[model samples]
Target: MGATMVEKILSSHALDRQLRAGDVVVASVDFAMVHDGRAGNALKMIEKMNAKALPFAHRAAFVVDHFSPPPNAEAANTHAAMRSFAAAHGARLYDVGSGICHQVLPEGGHFTCGDIVVGTDTHSTTYGAFNALGTGVEGTDLSAVLATGKAWFRVPETIRVELSGRLAPGVWAKDITLHMLRRLGAEGANYRALEYVGSAVEAMAIDDRMTLANHAAELGAKAAILEADAKTEAWLQAHGAAAPRPVRADADAHYAEVIGIDAGSLAPQVARPHHIDQAVSVAEAGTQRIDLALIGTCTNGRLDDLRQAAAVLRGKRIAPGVRMIVTPASRAIYLQALREGLIETLAQAGASVEPAGCGTCVGITGKLIAGDGEVIVSSANRNFKGRLGNPRAQIWIASSATVAASALTGVLTDPRGVAGGDWRVQ
Candidate 1:
């Protein structure tokens, strides 16, 4: 193969050639990172293997994010298991009561760009935001990697995603990603390596870029990567990362398909039941209104996103009938929002603020009543069937701005049209 960017990167660290699909290639793993709930499962898998020694014992990492502080007894058990696992195996851990696994790893300078890393959670793909060939695998796969510093894989074909223009006002990286699933369907990107590019891409922040890549699995993608540049470098530097230069895809990189999107024309998008591709514009999905509004998650939980929500709800209150919920992605974001008074703004607007974790996004903690008593506008990833607490109550997806605006008006409205080039005290 002449090799695309992914191929080049893989080849540079390849242990073999002609590693086709269905063939297990035990390539070296540059890193292995795990999170709270997943680490317990990975620990069980490692025990099953009866492994005595680790290939990269010190390189193994365990991070506690989901229920780290213990929202309940089960969560407490999970946290204890992780800490015990870290201690027993001499594994590195980031249990400083800080951010989620994805946010903390890159911020803590664990894996660098071009490192082929894997984790036990799907969102491990978040590392791809920094141009690492990072992806998620089973706990068993991670256990094998822990034992051998290598894992099996069959090379997946590549799909190119080309963003055509600047996003319109109120449309964020999350909007484009949700809308992409709308067109491509959940299974469309299955078993393929995804490459995202173009101008709209350039305008996105590392957090948003991560949100897009992390959601690739929602479409069944093997892995998704954004072409890295100076912005990526700056983000890594700001987060204290000293990543190596990433290999950029050639201008004419080989892709199974080139998908184009004109982001400037895109409105806030939402996905309906059962599949991510069931997405529609907030206006089209408008009649299916909402009763709850939530902001923040690994997908849309950045400082800028909170500011957008605050901007939209600066002076207004959420509709009396609707209950808005806010959860930041990290303890750092919580402190930042607290200092900025975004938490106060949301609370003042009748919103309920939860801890800094992935609580409501995936219907994990803030699960709703399973019937039609509520509809929601959430800034979470994947609005699939039974995804947001209710298989009956409809859930719409949008940016923090649109979610906030919808929460205020109790109806879906184009926030860009409402706010224009600036945030207003609406």
Candidate 2:
């Protein structure tokens, strides 16, 4: 019985030398993160615990992202408290407009391969894109990590998802994850690890892999990881990160189940309102009207995502009666987009470009205040009822290209049908 990638990472972090699936261990966390949404509460709990110091303060990060710029007085106070706490504790603090924690952490080179990282955000699994074992934890659990730099886990069984073929035109990583959700449902990988494998996954860029790993939480996965390879090394080198020590699963590694997907067979996919698992092909979803089109979030707010949206929006105007919003995931990405004229392209298309943050995704600001039954086509993840603040406001999740194409037509239009540059499939 060879060790899986997850098993190897866990064993390295675990106090027990022979950690395995179903075994309990207190693993050391290399890095921990807390976002504004949960920072105040986590701080309070840490105070209650009377922790004098955090063992990993240098590696810990506090981000003021959700509800950035302070939507209201209450949120402002929370952000202030978080800022004060971070400063006093010597933990790295990313102020409002810095970016979402998930994006900022990796973009800042805080994450490295083979590290066991945990955060207060479910999307913390985004770090898995670097081949690190990242998982989300509750506030209490995070407080424990803050106090002692350790947390417990029951090693999860691994599910090998082998992707084959190449993505077709206008389709992207977002569609791939949505297709998986449609096949596996919401709880498909509950309490399990999803190990992405195969040629298609290997061909995916680091940003694309982040998109897949970020959605693992929606599938109820404990963690979603990819084997570190040359692409990973290239990304790390470009970021000036240390030379990578890649982690690989043994050839005979045991998997609870193996699933294969042909990426070439996939089309643009959309998740209907109220549940992420209720996904259907864009054509099958029909031409539904939309009031807003959002083109950014931690899931799809990287530079490449913005470029894709820009390609569709350049030299075009957004549809009448539709408000389009584009938010970069980080300050770095925002600046890069500006340098490339992506920001101007979106603005010229009648889209409102907001600061880098999780605008509207958590419903703190930029929310839809439309009539009942209004629809929004968003690139952000999660389309649950009232996720964007109004229970009556419906959300349709799709790729940035799809969102931009639909923004031009005020309906669910596929990018392939629109006037856009050739699709750049990875």
Candidate 3:
């Protein structure tokens, strides 16, 4: 029988030995990424292991993004340690304002298609948008990879998700992913691979695809891969990455389950606080008041996402009582937004623009913490209790356009009801 994409990628990395679901193998990792949140532990593990040197230093990266600008002294110390480790190992290091690790790694041309990359962040699955087999691992596992350049894996079964029809106006990749979460639930695809295909997915831009893959972790996916085409090649080359080595699942590949979705019929989805799977249509969310409207993260902070939000807020102002913040995912994206006047547009709309980084998405920046009886609608991934620095503040997840529209009205307003420019992303 034919193999799924994950099976094929894992088998290729395992010396061309055919692999299937549940097969164990010690494969080589092409790249490893560690951020401030986990780099210290990884460095400590390496020291405890007493390894002579990091054999794969050149294939590794250290990024200080989660707590960029050293929100506190503790976070500053973590940055110091990351710098020391990067210099000692001769590895690449991205400092404050460089962006989230997931965006920084690829933008820095660290990995290419078909490469088996691992990171210390669950959102490492973001790299799967480039047709690479990227998954999350613990610091201990990352330490082993740095020391020996290898790691073990049990190939996961595949869940084939077929997306059909074009996305209606105001309905975008974020909404599609939120719908996936609502259908699959939090642990629905635990330790499994989700392979997305069909017309809707193909029509989506690379930025949109990143949003889909980045949030796959919320559905408990070990890896979420999208089929690559010319757009993938163009995006990699534009980012200075090496020529692509795209891979595809065979026509008759075995799948644990095959699910179909009609993108044309999907509406803007909102995931209630305390859980990502607690999703409902925007209309179903009712006219809930909001105090914060956040519009950036690794999940939806790309240039295109900013454009969509800008399209909604141009020549208008946010509600009188609402607070809006915009953060680009990377320095590159931030610069692009500036050149395109997206920054000024967002700022004029009463939104405070912060440096490009994880910012409030990880709660390390002390920006989006919620107070008692507060509600925040964010264009980010996770919304578990205390995810944004306070358990008392409720967080709702939605698309950037949705967040911007709600910000303009100070409630759970639908983007379709707001006057906006072209909502389609290139």
Candidate 4:
């Protein structure tokens, strides 16, 4: 049988061997990253390994996010260490406000199509949107790659997710992801690779594609990849990456399972508190009251996402009692939004714009804590208990449009009501 997309990537990166699902291989890493949360630990690991020098330092990156501006002295020290380490080793450092690791790496043109990329953050799967095989690794694993430029992996079996039809107005990639989470459960695709294909996926913009791949981790995916076509080439080139050498799976490639989704049938989906899989249509979620509305994260903090929210909030202010926070994923996205007046629109709507970083999504910075008996609707990924730094406050996950509409009304509101005109980013 022919190899799947992930298998093809692994075999290409491996040494003189044809890798298949279930086969273990030591592959060269094209790019590796460690964020502020894990950089200190990874540095300690490298020291523990007694490495005199970092041979592949140029291929690694250390990002200061999660605690971007240094919430406390401890976080400040961690940032200091990361800066020192990156400078000494000749590695790249994305300082505070640079953005989330996932967003910065791609924007910096660190990796390209068919490359094997790994990061210390779970959402490393986000890079798969570029047709690269990206996955998350522990700090120890990151240290090894930093030292040796190689990491081992077991080729995961592939799951074919075929998409058809287009999403309805105000129904975004986030809604589709939430629908998948509901269908697949939390770990339905555990240790497997998800290969997204078909007309609907091809029609998606790079931002939407990133959103889908980023959330594949919530399905317990080991890696997530999509077809590399003209869109992929243009995005990589625009970001300063080298010319693409895209790869595709054989038509008859073996897959563990094949699941299909009709995007036209999907609606604005909301994942109830403490569980991403507890998803339901916005209408079915009822008019749940919300005290906080967060509109940014690696998952939905791109320029398009901000524009979508701005479209809903233009000439309108958020509810009287609701507090809203809008964070851009990176400085580049932030600047672009500024040029487009998205920042001004959102701010005028009573949404506070924080520095570009993980911000309230990771709960390390930003005064996003929810008080007792309060409810939150966020555009970030993951809504587990205490995910927003408070176990007492409930969190709900939805699309940026949904979050913006809900913030306008102080409850869970379907975005289709007000997000139809001039919402899509051209």
Candidate 5:
């Protein structure tokens, strides 16, 4: 079959194929995961169906993230529910503070190339990082995965984004992606797999590539993939997955649309919602005071991001009322930051550093209380309504530096003013 990454992955795991739009297939799902935020809902659905989460390798993962270290005994109760269910079901579990689910999956070798996966969270599209045909589903749909180890999908078309050039300082991969989405609108890539290529994409880190794939869903793309390279190989090695069998489309690859983004000339970009496509350049995303600023999540929540925030707050303090919640992506990152004094420096700067978890991003934790507050700078993906504390809150998505600078200044401040050399990921 003439193929793309999506097609190739589906064929490898083909339970069935739907060449036309009206066709539907219930493919065997490889991995089905749920985090604290949605685990309870998924479990309830499974219980209703009188079934276990799943019984297969890489199936039935319970991730304890969303509310880490337990906001209170009530939150602890929620964690208990996940633990009990996972144990009873014989599933692998990553407790809170272990790292966001996305960070932990590859580490545990739960994700692999040519795999078909699904999860409850929207950002689940992120698994495409390893060339897996992955996407998000509603908790009900996810609960079915837990029950039957399968879900349905209508094959999506493809969108090809050919990225070129090395990124300039302060112009990271996230910025380049937001620019494209803003131009295309939130549903720009809806029901399509986005394949990113070019020199800029070739040079990106595995984490950076993951970030691009992470947010492609924001533009309504079903999934994203890159031609696997040395980085993918190295990353897969660490994950204990075999050397990544790189996948790519043929020269005559089919795409519903073709777009080009030159990372070299791009600057920092931000997505202010109501929509992810409502993007603005870092320098042009006019300054606006924020009630709360958060750094971390499955999306930019890694050591590199923490280091950038630390660099911006090396000698600064967060403005009062502008609560800055900094969460490390994983326990390892938290410990490394602790040893490196990044955590200490962040706390000293009036930032509320929490255990590695999701907060203020997914709206389930670290809620803000400002009445009628708008525009919270965060590093998480998808700024949907009621996503972080308030349905009315405006979330301005940007790089870690912008989030930190905004926390320090109480206003959206560009990170361009901050020196980069002084930053260290360690």
Candidate 6:
């Protein structure tokens, strides 16, 4: 049988040059990343292991995000330690305000096709948008990679997700991911690799692909990758990255399973509180009153996402008694939004634009929804109970456009209702 993309990449990096599903191999890592949340723990492990130096310091990055600006003295000390560790080990350290690690890594041209990149964050799979093998690891695993420049992996069976047709108006990659979550429960793809294929996926922009790949982990996927093509090359080129080496599965590649989806059949999807798989259509979800609306995160904080939100909030203002927050994923995206006046537009609409970082996505910092039974519509990935820092508060996950539209009326308003014309303030 012809080799799948995952098999090809694994075999190429494996010592034996032969790999199959469930086969364990020690492969060299192309890049490794850690954010402030896990950096202190990883550093402690390295010290405990008595590591003299990292074998691939140049390829490792330490990002001070997720609580950017230090919410407290303890966080400040942790950031200081991470910075010291990065400087001493010669690893690149992106200080506070640099943006989320996943966004910064790719925006800075550290990821490319066919590379094996790992991060201490579960959303590390975001890198797979570029056709790279990205996986999240624990602190112990990260420490081993840092000490030896290699890590072991059991080659995951590949599940081919074939996409056909384009998304309908008002729907987005976030909705698609949420739809998949609803179909395939939380553990559906456990220890498996989700390989997105077909015309619809190929037609999607890199940012959209990132949204799909970022949430694969929520389905228990070990990794999710898209086949690199011309669009991938164009995005890399536009970002000043070197020419990428595209990788594709062989024509006769074997897959564990094949699932087909018609993107045109999908509509706006929302994930209710306490579980990402608790998804329902906007109509089924009804008009949920919201006290806060958030419009950014690693999943949907790129320029395109911000622009879409800005387009909706242009002439309208957020509803009374509702607070809205917008955060860019990276410094570069923030600058671009500023140049395009997206910041002013959001502020004029009563949305507070915070610095580029994780913000309230990780429940680290931001004006979180207070009081029991409070509701928030956020574009971030997860909406589990207490995910936004209050167990009493509920979160509903949707696309940036949906969040923006909902912010206008302080309820779960569908973006389609506001698209194609000026939004009337109630």
Tens-place lDDT digits, model 5, residues 1-426: 367777666655554552432245667788877888787677777667765435552376788888786777777887998888777778888997798887777777776777777877777878887777778876778767766777777777888888888776555667877888878888888788888889987777777777888878778878887777777777788768744656677776566888887778887788877677788886786767788788888888877788788888887778887877888888877898899999998999988877776755666675554346566788887787777668777888888877887787788877776654134322
Report every candidate's CA lDDT: 0.75, 0.87, 0.89, 0.89, 0.76, 0.85
TM-score of 4: 0.98
Candidate 2: residue 139 lDDT (0-100): 76
Model 1: clashing residue pairs?
Answer: 274-385, 291-375
Q: Which 10-residue window of candidate 4 scores lowest in summed lDDT?
A: 417-426
lDDT per residue for candidate 6 within 1-426, as digits (tens), equals 788888888888886866788889999888899899888798888778887767777788999888787888877888999888888878889999999998999888887889899999988989889999999997888888888989999999999999899777677888888898999997789999999888878767777899899888888898999998887877777776656767788888889999999998988888999889999988889868999899787899988788878888887788999999999999999999999998998899999888888887966564455568889898999888888878999999998888988998888988888853222111
**lDDT, residue 275, model 3:** 88
TM-score of 1: 0.92
- lDDT score of model 6? 0.85
- Each candidate structure's TM-score, on Cα atoms with residue i matched to residue i, is 0.92, 0.97, 0.98, 0.98, 0.89, 0.96
Pairs that collide in candidate 2 are none
| Candidate 3 clashes between residue pairs 3 or more apart in a chain or in different chains | none
Candidate order by lDDT, decreasing, is 4, 3, 2, 6, 5, 1
Those runs of model 2 whose alpha carbons end farther than 4 Å from true positions after fitting are: 364-369
Model 2 clash tally?
0
RMSD value for candidate 5: 2.9
Note the clash tally of each candidate: 2, 0, 0, 0, 0, 0
Which wins on lDDT, candidate 2 or candidate 3? 3
**After superposing candidate 5, which stretches have Cα over 4 Å from the reference?**
15-23, 51-54, 71-75, 143-148, 318-322, 369-371, 391-393, 421-426
